[model samples]
Every structure is written in structure tokens, then in C-alpha cells.
Target: MNFSVGPPGLIIAAPRSGAGKTTVTLGLLRALRRQGGAVQPFKCGPDYIDPAFHEIAAGRPSFNLDSWAMGEELIATLATEASAGATISIAEGVMGLFDGAAARGRSGTGATADLAALLGWPVVLVLDVAGQTETAAAVALGCARYRDDVDIAGVILNRVASQRHFSLVAPAFDRINMRIFGAILREDRLALPERHLGLVQAGEIPAIDQRLDALADIIAAAIDLDAIGQSARPAKAAIAIREAHSDGARSRLQPPGQRIALAQDRAFSFMYPHVLRQWRHAGAEIVPFSPLADDPPDATADAVWLPGGYPELHAGALASAHSFREGLQKLARRSIPIHGECGGHMVLGRGLEDADGNRHEMTGLLGLETSFAKRRLHLGYRRARLRIACALGAKGTEVLGHEFHYASTVSTSDDPLVDCWDAAGAEVPEQGARQGSTTGTFFHVIDRIAI
Candidate 1:
């Protein structure tokens, strides 16, 4: 369906992870922007890192559009809002094109296909033609035939060894009438840096622009930018216009307060892009403070939001951030709502033990002890039912969120935060802890329930 909200858009997806989706997506985004087009970037799942690189490539803020954790209505609202004021919107898919949460939706539940069908965006599948040449076409053909809701418009061959390699791979697609865009040569430099979570955050890498530009050069030389732009189209279904209901007044997640003191630095900077955007849309004022730089939250602000980042890496510095600790302590004393997620939750504990087993003093707002030394991966979509009403919602209210952390709880208070369930609704142990007005949890809320 054609959308009047913006110009044509497309999804860069693949059969699987490590199939060069990120590289191709970034390259195409950079290549598109290099031509002086306004590009709006998006990631299909609950990832914060990829959107960072997407922003650097597109020269604008990239938002997350999750189908599993978030309701379909919320995802469409986010996509519609993100595409505003742009020539084109490009969403990089999570995992394989068909891989998504287990649900009964338009496209195999929460798969990238679901997101594509939801947004009415055609997909350009990226195939990694590493060793096999002709077999790549079979894979692309399977993806095309497997799903009816999604449109597999074209294919881009990545990691081709030579011209001969392209020749062997191109004919199979040609024979099948598949549009083959371009074959990217095998290059090690195209691989982006990685860490424990995913691709290194854009800010962590030095000269990311130069790196993206170099990638763009490689992609532009190989791919057909004009053809891609022509094939890109808006959502097939018309988007429903949503009116802002007074900065979070009718928010899914209860607004912390009218004035929120948000922690915004390298250490605590994983706030959901859409959450803050919608909060502002609701008319709430955000006051940012740098806890990593030893800055304090504004005293006048009523709520303090500590987002998750790499606080364990800077445990010593945070332990010594006099103003940050003192200011938050002051707020805690005033019974103001202080919410912490993931690493921020670690910082709100009595002590944080880094990877080396060295303990560092924390805000002591929550009577819990956590450590990175005993790291255990807890990663998945979460559905939480509030046991008690705080800032999130009234008691028994539900919210959709995701948890991705490697910190282990050493100790916790008797009072728990919320009861959680996996994506499929299996009950999880009551996770997180609450003390006074302070609430700490590893779950980073993506969206509250549609109701």
C-alpha cells in the first residue's frame, strides 16, 4: 500500500544472522544518504546498538520497531512517526527475514516478515555467497516462496570472491527471474566491530563516519542505487494518525513525572528511542545529566531515569562520582520515583562487583548486591505484571519489555519488583526488587500493553 506520510521505503533483510544484513543495510543507508537524500533508519527488533550505527549512516535518529514485545498498533505508530520528514525509510531486520517471535500474526508471528507486512515495505534479501555460488539462488528462491505476506523484491549477493563467483551466482537468479542487484566482493574491512551484546555502539567506535563512508564507497561501486530507490515503496496499508495525548498523560508506561531527570552519558544511555520521543510528544520535559562525567540530575526534576549501559566498566568512576550519587541519594530521600534498568539497576544496588571481583560502592537506594564476575546471560522478550503501582502503572497492569544483561544478582530485598513471563507467556520467577520509591529491574521496557 502506498503511504502519503513519506517517500518509498524498503527493508534490508537476510536468511540468517551473519549473512551480512548489517553491512549491507549500513552500506545502503550511507550510499543513499551520500546522494543527498533524507534517509530515516530503523531496526526491526529490540536492539539498541544497531540503531546507533544506523543513525551515523543515515545522519538522523534511528528508532526501534519491535513486533513481538510491542503490539502491532504501537509498531505501526512508531514506523509512521519515524518516516516523517524523510525521503526514504530503511529498516534493518533482526535475525533472518522469517525469524521472529512465536506468535500467530501476518508473517509467522513476530518475524521480520511480520514487520515488513505490518509496515507495507518490500524486502531486499541479502545472501552471503561465501563458498557456494549457485546454491545461493536456491536459498533466495526458498525465502521468496516460503512467505506470501512479504514481498522479496530483490537480492544482493555479499562476500563474492571474484567476478567468476558473481557469474556463477547471477545466472541461477536470472533463470528464476529474481532481481539480482549487485555482488559485493569479499572484504574483511566491511565487517563491523562486535562486543558481548552485538555490534559495538556507534559512539564507541572512532571515526565511525569515515568507516561508514568507506563502506558506502564499496557498496555504491557494487550495487545499483538508482534501481533500489525506484523499487522502494511506502506501506501498502494507510497508517492511522495518532494524536499526542499530553506528554505521556495517556502513556502506556506511566510518565515518571512532568519533569524527568534522565541519565544520558556513555555509561547510562540505553533509553528506548521511541519511549523518549513519545514522552516528549506527550509534553513531558526531559532534563539530561551525565552520571559518567560526574554530573548530577537536576534538583527540580521529580523523576530520575537511569537507563542501562556499561556501568560495570566504569564502576570505580561511578563509585567516586560524588555529585551523581549525592544528587540521586537526595532524590531517594525525597521519596521521588527513581527507576533503574539493567546496568542502572546494578548502580542502584549497595555494591557492584566488576568482572575482576572488585567491589564498588553504589547509590544504596535499593538493598541489592549485583556482580559482573558471576555473569549469566539473561536475554529475551519479557511481559511484566506490576505487583504494586509505581511509575510504570497501577497494580496488576502489564507492560511488554526485553531483558539483555550479564550481571548476576548477589543479593536482593524481600520485596520484588514485578512478575515476569517469557514471550510465550510462561511465568518467570518474580524478578527485580523494589524498596521505598526506588525500583530496579533488568528488563528494559519497550512498550506497555495496548490497553
Candidate 2:
């Protein structure tokens, strides 16, 4: 029932991708934090990477605000909950404002614009003014006129060449009447590295604080933080927020003590925080253990969970983690339910080959071999139907989740992790995989649905 009432605001974004949305967002977050602002940052959509930088900037755990996956009530609830103790909130938008759950001709629904319209937040367009000058104004103008739903507050020009470039671009915005927020200097320090999953899981980045601080300073010098803070409007009436435990009514019949040991480390970090919270609310005590730390679960837990992350990066360490491997084996021998997600799915395989084509041993629970050698990116918003019993549910259970990874399984058998479908209703081969009481897959279960 906790509520947040303060100088909360949002960042409406994206004229396009690679337009420096992430950099600008990170810079603003860091700069605001540096200025002694309790900035609660939220990433629109189901992205895990951007939230990492948000956390770094806000000095708090950043949460995802997916308009597509979650209902409006949930969005308001999450935003209000996250904003409780902060001076202001910054919601970094995803993709282009209009770009949504799917490409132009698709059926999926989540998008930056969709979120903006739902939350009633102002848009601060981060336009890439690299090649075009006044035409960039036309682009911004078109975005403004394209949808009456978005409130295009201002513009931030990225990759500016010189004062000369702004000299030209600023005039164009003047012609279109879009206020120019600020221009980020085209510096290498402001950029973060990217890979198949997104910006190399923030944990993988060395000297993360220094990187964040540098980006913050760069942005602070450019942006007027006061104006940005002023851009935040008062949230809707207090009744708008849903309770954190609002979804508990659906799980009144589930039993308690079905304990689960979750894998948490650089290799298995794709878990949704809300999901864990809801599981606990639903009578499951989730025990967290680390594969990277070479630790095993205490023998008392009834189930094991390995969420997704960069297992490919630490295949060597994970393969050599005798305590964890033996512990999983022992737990499986005792008929304890074991489940794995993307990176977890890979870890349960017989072997895992890194990006370099070198193979390493894994837990071998699923008798599958996975590799990033071929590196076919399987990214999508997935909907799955359980065809058989597993740790979280039984056959015929439907769940909404996401798939984001670059590794693929080299399977000799047709046994899949789970029987599922995508948002498009196409049969997804392995919603997840199972061996005895152990199961793993690339699906990211949405916490809201379970709640």
C-alpha cells in the first residue's frame, strides 16, 4: 500500500534506434544522481540491460515498466511503488516512439509510444542529428504529428558534429517549433558496448561506476536538469495504483514449502524481480544460490531454478564449479524439480561452446549441447502452453514470456524443453525442456500473470 508522491517525471524517447537513446538516458540518470537527486529510473518494455544503467545512476534497483506485457493498472502500480522515496523518476523509452511490440506488419502490441500514451508522460525525443540537419526537424515534426497521443516535450540532438551542426539543426527545430533540450557531445566515453543480447550485461562492463559518472558529467554539462524535472506531471489520482499483492487472489489454493533454489550470477541473471516476489507470495520460498561463486543449494530445497544470463561468457567457470554441478545432480537424484531459462537451459545441456568454438562441460541434465558458435539470435515475445507437468505448473497451463538469446541447442532428439506458442500462435518447439524432474528453456515468464 506504499505510495510515491514527489517530483517524478518521465523520458519519452526514440525517433529511432542507435539514435543514442540508451546513452542519453544513462547520462541523464547519472547526472541527476550526481546533483543529489533521488532519481528512480524505469525502462519501458521488457529490457533488462537499460535497467542496469538506471540502477547505477539512481543508486537503486531499477524496474521494468512494460506497457505491452502489463496492464495500465500494473504500470501505474509499479511506477508509483518505484517512485515512493525518490525526488523524480525517469522512464527511458524503447525503440522509436511509434515502433511497437512487433515490426510494421505484425500483431504484437508493446511499444514506447504505447507506454507513453498509457502513462501520460511527456516525450523528450533523442534525435540522431548525425547526417541530416533541418530534415531532422521534419522527422521530429512528423513524429509529433503522427500520433496525437504523445506529448513531444523537447529534443536532444546526439552525435552532433560541431556548433555548426547544432547551428543548422537548432534552426530546423525552431522552424518546427520543437524545443531543443540539449546536445550531447559526440564523444566515445558516452557510448556503451553492444552485443547480441544488448549492452554486454552491465556486470560484464569493467569500471561501471566510472563509465556511468563520465556519461553523467557529459550530459549534465549539456542538459538543463531543472527543465527536465519540471517536465514531470502529477500522477493520476491515488486510486490509479494497484497494490503490490493485487494478484494474490488467483493463487489462494497453492500449497506452501515447495521451496526453490534459484541460480543467480553473471551467467544466470535474466530473472524478473516481480516474479520472485510473486512466487514468495504464492507460497514458494525462493532460495538464491550462485553458479559463478561455485556454491551449491542447501539440500533442503524442493526445486531448483536457473534464470537466464551470459552463461556463454563464463562457460569455463560454470563447468568447473564442482560444488554447484554435484549439488544439482544430487538434487535431481532426490527427485527435486529443477528448472532453467535461456542461459540456464544452456547450462543444463551436456556441453556448451563459447563464442570461440571451444566446448566446455555443463550439468548434462537435458542431454543437449548448446553453442554460441553459430550465434543465431532467437529474440521474440513468446506465449507458451505447458504440455506436461513442470515445477511451476502442470500440462495445459498457458504463460506469457519472452525469448532473448544468441545460443542454440544442437539436439539429436526431438524432446523439447516445453510445448509452447509464440505471440503469433505458432508452435514454439521447446517452450522449455525436461528430464525427469529437471526442466530448462529460453522463456522469461512474466511475473504479473503469475501474480
Best by lDDT: 1
Q: For residues 318-420, could you state the per-residue lDDT of candidate 2 as single tens digits?
A: 9999999999999999988888878887898789999899999998888878888997878777666666767657566556667888777776342554566
Across 400-448, the per-residue lDDT of candidate 1 in tens digits comes to 7888988888888748879998877788764777888999888898777
Clashing pairs in 2: 417-432, 417-433, 418-431, 418-432
The number of residue pairs in model 2 that clash at the backbone is: 4
Model 1: lDDT of residue 371: 88
* Per-prediction TM-score: 0.95, 0.90
Off by over 4 Å in 2: 1-7, 103-108, 243-259, 280-286, 412-417, 448-451
lDDT of 1 at 298: 92
Mark the 10 consecutive residues where model 2 has the least summed lDDT.
Answer: 248-257
Q: List lDDT for all candidates, in order.
A: 0.84, 0.75
